[model samples]
Target chain A: MRDKTILLVEDNQDDEDLTLRAFKTNNISNRIIVVRDGAEALDYLFGEGAYAGRDLSMMPTLILLDLNLPKIDGFEVLKRVRADSRTRRLPIIILTTSHEQEEVFRAYESGCNSYVRKPVDSAQFRDAVRDLGLFWLIHNVPPPESE
Target chain B: MQTKRFAGGLRIALVLAGIFLALASGYLAGIREAQMKASGPALTRDLTIVLFGQTLHLRLSLSALGVTIIFVLTILLAAAVLFARVAHRRRRQVEAVNRKLMREIGERKRAQDEVIQLNAELEQRVAARTRELQTANKELEAFCSSVSHDLRAPLRAIDGFSDALLKDYHDKLDEQGQQHLQRVRNATQRMAQLIDDLLSLSRVTRTEMRREEVNLTAIAREVVTELRQIDPGGNVEVIISEGLVAQGDARLLRQVLENLLGNAWKYTSKQPAARIVMGTCKGRNGKPAFFVQDNGAGFDMAYASKLFGVFQRLHSASDFPGTGVGLATVQRIIHRHGGEVWAEGSVGQGATFYFTVY
Candidate 1:
């Protein structure tokens, strides 16, 4: 439970299930901690609301965020996280169903480390997840903790 | 200088006086003959005289005949003058009528020229507007291309990373964990399709149209074949009447068929057996018309007006996958050909699109 974790911020249940499956298929060992919306994801990350009692020192290795949500969308969440001293350098990946050009550029402008679009074919979906998990887990080194 | 009416009155009066004079001359001749027959020594004159008691009058020989001769000469002069006056008045009236007629003809000619000039100016203005619209369409197409390029970058990253994640982690994830990965991939693919449709709409509007005689049947058949490739399992029968030709841009006509027939294929995916037909008939304007009829998931009649509007979709995204640009593109193409396009459908029954390039 204390090992490196993944913060998956997604609204749709089906998409959330698929992400979990992608991680498993790719053989990633990190524990996936999912929130249903951007607000909940922030709450969990900052140890606020229901997660007030949770330990703040247990930081996740990566955050996968969806752009569109019920309230407090991913851009606001990313901005808030980057502005704060404690979680400014946290690796945030934008994983959404939107392929709008403005959305991609905006995500990068707002300090997201990476962006991803969902795929249709199940096999192709599985393959994309496999590659993504491998690259981040094996190739990319996590940034150091902020002061 | 006498007025024509005054001169006419003078001539008539002179003519009456001459008639009396002629009668007097004849009477004088008669009296002279009678005198000669009676064997008179000398016949000097015949006269009738009137006098008062203090006045005396003498009659001269041949005095009546002299007066009659002068009277006849004056009457002949008056008659000639009267005829000339009447001729002069008639000539003046005729001249006035000719001048008025010429003026009226000139006015009508000017009005006709002005009308012709106005029509030419209106045509020039319409040409200018068409050019402006074409330029606007080009700009929109450029914008769409840029958007598509920008959108594709992130999509690639999404698919790439998810694949990496699934590849590097397998043993640790439970069955529930595995399902989440699949959903992420599905969403990305749907987004890519929407972007593609946006690009297609932009392309259709921007491209310059080259019109020629096009075979509608060939386009329909080709589109049907393409649709079958996309949905192999979906059973749909397509009937196309061969050799129905029209004056239009071939590429645009092909796009129109693709959109209409493609919609047929997509909507009829749920049906056990689908029927689609393409044929020609007389249009509402009594012109040659083409039609695409399909038995599919048709839309509500109330929302029919929105069918050709950009991004206006009647069905939900979760049910029917589209960016809602196909029919809009089709409409634009048909309109550019100087033709008309319309659709008829009811919920769950079917849809038919009719177009004419007259």
Candidate 2:
């Protein structure tokens, strides 16, 4: 399960549920872990707080980050993750409702692997989620694991 | 300017008068010398008869002439002295007037300098105020973008969740519950549309306009075609004149045409045979104005002033669906191009929107 784990950092419960449903409908059966805020995401990433005893070597293959979070925000999370060697090469995708060009530019500038706008229509959103899951989980090869 | 000319005329007149006085005094002195010469022989004859000195008559006449000549010369010298005194007084008066004029000119220069200084200060103040206004506008633009970003998130959540419920839990819910959920979804979608329209309106204000020669006729044709595609069965008659051009941002002008033509199309939906015309005409100010006229459900003239305002609507949502931001966006785009937009309409008759790019 080293590269099959997918961590989703999102504060809104409704969005989290919708995303999970989209993945399930698309048959993306990867072990999915959810963190509610940016700080918790950081804690889980560095193997601290509730995730202290967890093995740091078993890092997730992809991370879905929401920009508007309760603590530290998605940009700061991306920055910190890219700064550390353990999670620096982790493929992080910004999954947000904002289609603003500035936000997209900042996400890519902050080392996000991809940026996707959350569609208001459920069918379109499902399709977008399916495509993303298939592309990152099945098609794209992951970076070599760092010691 | 008149006073300076008058003063110059007076100076010339005084100099001429002084010269005339001097010449007249000289002529009088010459006449007195001639009279003394003519009476000289008679005076000598009278002296010879009275005295036993017939031989001394010439000497007496000569002495008498000398006395007369001396008296005449003294009177002439006195007259000359008086004329010189008068001329000197006139010169002093003219000099005093000249000094007063020089002082007035100095005062005028000071006043003019004060005016210049005041103008400079006012210009500086205007520049500073303009800078302040620019800064405020920038801040407002930043605030608007962030607000739009924040507002869309929750709307998406509501829309997304309702859609999930309807798709996944349809079997568990009753008919009433399903309708309620559908209404919720509809309301959320409408709200989302409103937010998007609001964002576009704000963007119209902040976007830097790129100006170029735009083919207004072509743009109108494109917009009308799109509208027709939207309602493929629409029996509306569209008439577009050729060679309508304007100088403005092409993208923004397209938006203007879209809003105006779209509005005309929507309002005329109830008409059996609707007519829409897009063309150019001379405006009230005699400038070339492009207009979109339609035989639609026109509005009241009294409420025309509120037509371009944001969120202002004359018709009910059920009759016509809109966020009421289209016209406001159109007005903003036109105003950015230094243009004016106004509408004329009569209830149940028709409406026309006119705009001119300066």
Candidate 3:
């Protein structure tokens, strides 16, 4: 349990607060890192900029990405993460407000692990977040590391 | 131009005549001089002449006879040369006219070809512009959807916190305070519904359509079954026409039936023994029209024009609940298939919606 961590990259403050509350309500109980935009997310992931000299071995177990963001959008962040050999196997789930089929297909085609829409109904949103945590944080197995 | 050409020909003819007369006179003068200067034996010659009723004999000068014969030959030769020159000039003028006509015909042919080429180019340009405009329209629709989608986040927050206040501090709030919170929650939810409905309306227009032979009868059967499940307590009867087949997009046609039949189910909720019929009949111009009719709380005919407008409802929200987007969507789909839709009913007399797919 102590080994798992989740990174949330969302720009909107309201959405960030709601997502945090939903995670807490579901008893996810993992180390959660929040970044405001795409550029900050990259810095945190690559241990660069403000995160310089941080231990790169402690990688996030899961990534929740919002497609609409400032300073490089979600697709670019997903691309750079997958391109790096050190972080290619991390699970990247797209969490956004759009349920359009074209956008969903595009997310999967660009190598996202899962796609989920942020429902306007808060109770439904909590249930979706809980199911996501149950699957990724506990039930599913992660690839073994060199350590 | 014709008069000028004729005048030119006349001037040449007159000049040739003057030269001919001058030459004849000069030859006659020379003949006279020769006859006057010659001896009698040289100038004279014996001659015999025969007339209609008498004969005559005379002696004539040889030189005068020779001079007369030479003068006659010279006159004839000059006349022949002059006629030939005029004929050659007339032939050249005719050739010049023919060449002008040929040049005119060639120019007209080139101009005609240029026009045809221009028409083809214009058609190509029109097609390209139409495609560009279609692309721009699609982008605008997408932008509208995005803005509406982003609006839901704050609304969810408002509704969620209202629930929080109600759930966490139930005893701390007074009755009026609780009611106010409930109202706030309701308004937020309604706004969310509006956003969803708006997105769907735009989606229907933007979606691509595929035409095939669709068994609308079967689709209606499925929609009615679903409606029955939703409103199981109502004792509503549904009658569907057999073999209602048409050419259209199957998915979109299914949506049309759902909206129409769903309305039929919803409006008749107050009836004790409700009857809803889905059938085909002859419409205006004798075209086959499909209709969904119900013995429900029908609306006044005066407000019929506003029935299909977005969020427009003839009945009060308390009486009947709807987003009023269904009929508009139906109209769009049918119109896409080159069809028309209309309705007919009076107050409390039940309503029938008729639509044709061309």
TM-score of each: 0.46, 0.62, 0.72
Give a tens-digit lDDT track for model 1, residues B100-137: 98899899899999999999999999999989887876
TM-score quality measure for candidate 1: 0.46
Q: Identify the candidate with maximal TM-score.
A: 3
How would the docking of model 1 be graded?
A: incorrect
State the DockQ of every prediction: 0.06, 0.32, 0.39
Residue range B1-358, candidate 3, lDDT tens digits = 6567556766665666667566666776687677667733344677776778678776755544555465556556655665676677778898999899889999989999999999999999999999998998778667864766578878878877787788779999999999999989878877777777667677677778899999989999999888888878889999999999989999888888988898888888888889999989998869999999999888888888887777888877678777777778877888888888888888777889888987
Candidate 2 residue-wise lDDT, B65-123, digit = tens = 55545555655665665566567767988999999999999999999999999999999
Clashes of each: 55, 0, 7
Task: Give fnat, all candidates.
Answer: 0.11, 0.41, 0.41
In angstroms, give how far residue A92 of model 3 lies from its true place.
3.5
Which of the numbered candidates is closest to the native, going by highest DockQ? Answer: 3
Model 2 chain B: worst 10 consecutive residues (lDDT sum): B41-50
Clashing pairs in 3: B43-B61, B43-B62, B44-B60, B44-B61, B44-B62, B45-B60, B45-B61
Model 3 lDDT tens row, A1-147: 347999999999888888888898889888889999999999998999999987988988899999888998888898888888878888998999877666777778778999988877777888889998999988878766543
